[model samples]
Target: MQFAQFDVAAFLNAHWQKRPLLIRNPWKAWANPLEPDELAGLACEEGVESRLITSGGKQGGGKLALERGPFAEERFGTLGKEPWTLLVQAVDHYVPDVAALIEPFRFVPDWRIDDVMVSYANDGGGVGPHFDQYDVFLIQGLGRRRWRVGPVCDAQTPLIPHEDLRLIEDFEATGDWVLEPGDILYVPPGFAHDGVAVGDDCMTYSVGFRAPSRAELAEAWTAHQVDAMAEDDRYGDPDLSLQAHPGEITAEALDRLHGMVLASLADRDAFARWFGHYNSLSKYAETDWRPEEQMEAEEVAAMLGEGHGLHRNPAHRFAFIAAGEGVLFFVDGVCRECRGEAAQLARDLCAGNEWSGSPSEEALALLAALINQGSLGFEEED
Candidate 1:
């Protein structure tokens, strides 16, 4: 489940977000985690993000086609055998073995990690040549896949006229390779790349990272700050003076207006707290991850007394930020201010450590709350 031999520092400094690097069977003992049939079953489940891409169109011998799922179980059998691929997003959220793959790549910060998207493709099957805005490490899990790496692309790059797929008009490969099981290829953001199965039953796991655009951050931050702002908190001109020209706005007025906006947005501490919650928000926010029955403090204490371990839910996000003597622990969009033993517990939880040692009463309460909300669960429950 971990890397056999690799230089993390060197890779980050020389290749990360700079260029593509091909790693040959880096795992100590590489084993395919999810079966093709298992992945297909996930595609047929509700609330699972999935896509079916057909090269010769859905009906066959036409333009490329894209179909969103939860698809009918019979649909897979009917798709003409013209090279199609089934991609299920956030496979790690559903598969524990698949989620363990992310642990090896923890050199990258937790928040930057998006999720592991697993795709199963037949011979000559691929989603087409396209560039992603975020970085991704493509891990070949089953069968061989021929990957064509092209130059970096941007908004100006020309695309083929396909309604669903944003395929490059004429992709030129700078490097090419056929990856076997356990092999990995890291593709930086905005780089054009294409992968097609060399033979049948090819499966690839894509561990993609989140690279929020400037506009996205600005918009989200603005929305958050606005929601907290009061209507009464408006621009004021206590020291108003008559302007020489009534039609012209004075420099003094402009400065005050600009300062008002900047002052409201320049709270680094407030932004840090807001971002901790924002970043910890689950990718699948619409899907409820709460436990079937609300966990009680008595139950949590009984389990802890029995020497049961606590673990995080892979589907939920967990992060913490130091605040004075305590920490702000954010989980699934909820933030809890932890002090003393609770603070230490938060650190341990984020570090993926199991419950150990005696915990304070406050710590037990926090644990119960987390378990009740489905952010943390007993190791046996997993």
Candidate 2:
């Protein structure tokens, strides 16, 4: 997909996370990558996460309904019947075409490009007026939907609470537009918007951004660091006096804890590895597969020689091979260590796209290992 010719870098530098900017026909002739039935089927699966929203009236001021993750098949029985909607998150991880549509936006940091969520709405369906903490670009796909968005001014503002959805209480729309297929609307954080499908079959793709809260980052990083520490020598408190004094847990001890935290983060390589692995992991449920048993090296080499394709597992964002010494191995987006021929082989595999011609002995071995570990495999073209 050719990106809209706007200076993405400049736009991002200027308005990203600051204000919303809409670009019309960003992807000319943009197609709906997944059909409504495919999406609904995926939502019904136990591994997939999904949500449903129903609104009461045309003005969108009515009873709200919500349901969350791992939805049951029976829940989708009335999908095409009335004023309701279903949203399936992280479609790109499973659908290659959908994932490829997002590659153009890789200019934005991987950490910021959260996931692609597809929403299918029936006539007069909406989730109510609400503001997101992160930025998003809503791409119109199947049909038309009217949207109204307003700026968020206060944190303590009241909201209309449904069973599982939080909607703004007194959202005043500053902008309104009808989105047709291929049209795009950018909404920055704190923009209260409500989208109601005008037609019976409307599908929209929401490319969401990640806004990690300070508390969330601290919790994730601290847990990772603590786990790493467990593999090493334990934190020692040599001065053990049985006397229980609340004041005795002095500022110095607190400082020591802080120091340990900083020390863990100080290893730049370790931190980068963690961040890369964390972001690359897929957010959606993936299909499980078992590799063919006892495949010979010659058979693997022959398959690679015949130009078999390799796709990175949706469940696995990164793969790494350990290299001795100071060398690090990075495949897809994951990091590890490698040396000599192994390092070269890893690079070729991670270089993106399909591999032509025969795979080297080392490459074949690596691919075999990846397949065995349920991380990657060869796909035969029909």
Candidate 3:
């Protein structure tokens, strides 16, 4: 569904990350996507990450409850009438309906987009008051859920220590409202909030965006660079000036070393390529995305000749960035260089789920590789 009526620029300027905003029933006709039974089925799958939280203690909000899932069907029946919630992450990767929820919000850059996490809750059910390190758009799907948003929280904010979950120690709601179907709440990073199902069949789709910490960037990027660095590519000074104190490293030597380090990290080209691969890494990295049999270049050409296009796997993460004279295209953690028509193909794949244009030979090769990797599929496969 296209958000042709929504003001994208106004929302970004006013509430992207600055604060929270409530958009009441923005869609013309908002249809609930996944049913609770489907969500429960997904939770039972071993490969899918899920959680079951049965709130206990005072008002059913305490540290005494929570369980990881791959649970048996009987477990749902055993939960009883107690307040509980089921949360499944990256639902978009598995369900096309859930993935469609991300399309409307494409006003934001594609690289910034994460995944859709769907949750089902019973009356009085909640994950407890807490803050996230990433921005999220909470869209009510099935039933009513009363949400409470408090003051902004940060690193200093105290959390109730638990093995599975980190909940706020104490929270006071500054604003409370019940969200009906199609309503949306935009919560920026580090804001405290809680949501409880007003009744049964309550479902919420959380479209989240991540903010990589400085420490994370340093560790991951440095690790990538270290592996790629040559052994002889070490600190070298061709002309070293003598110093009065031999114990003290000369400023010139230190300057050369620092310059080398800066030069390595500040290589925009290398960083661009690295980031394309880095950000394209799927949340389900261990889950293989390869097709059973790789399609040949001839088959691809024939398909394109027959007016068939390319489609991206819902489970794959695809993106591209303009790098110097060419483009760096990334799909499911693999990076490829693109030029000419191939570059346009990369951009098209990133922007849309399907591609219909005639493929150049170079584009055919890249598409074949992605198809073999199981991230790109022929339109006829649909």
Candidate 1, residues 78-139, lDDT tens digits: the string is: 87668989999999998989999999999998989999999999898998899999999999
RMSD of each: 1.6, 4.4, 2.2
Better of 2 and 3 by TM-score: 3
TM-score of each: 0.97, 0.81, 0.93
lDDT of 1: 0.91
Tens digit per residue, CA lDDT, model 2, 1-382: 6565657888879877777666677774577788998888888877677888865554656577777757766777755444888898888767876776666666665546677889998888877788888888898888999999888645787886555877888888888899888888888888789999998789998988887788876787778878867566545668745656766776667777778768876876676676666655555425454365746668777776676777655445543434344335543344656556656666655545344455567666766766665566677566
Deviating ranges (above 4 Å) for candidate 1: 57-62, 353-357
Clashes of 3: 0
Ranking by lDDT: 1, 3, 2
Error of 1 at 326 (Å): 1.3
Query: lDDT of candidate 2 vs native?
Result: 0.72
Candidate 3: tens digits of C-alpha lDDT, residues 1-382: 5453678889889888989988888887799989999999999998999999986756755544879988899999987677899999999988877898998998888778888999999888899899998999999999999999999998788888888777888899988989999999999998999999998999999999978889999899988988988999877666766779979977787788888988778887788788888988888888987878888888888988898877788788888887777788899888888888888888888889888766888888888888899998876553
Which sections of candidate 2 miss by over 4 Å?
Answer: 56-61, 69-82, 153-155, 230-261, 284-297, 319-335, 339-353, 357-359
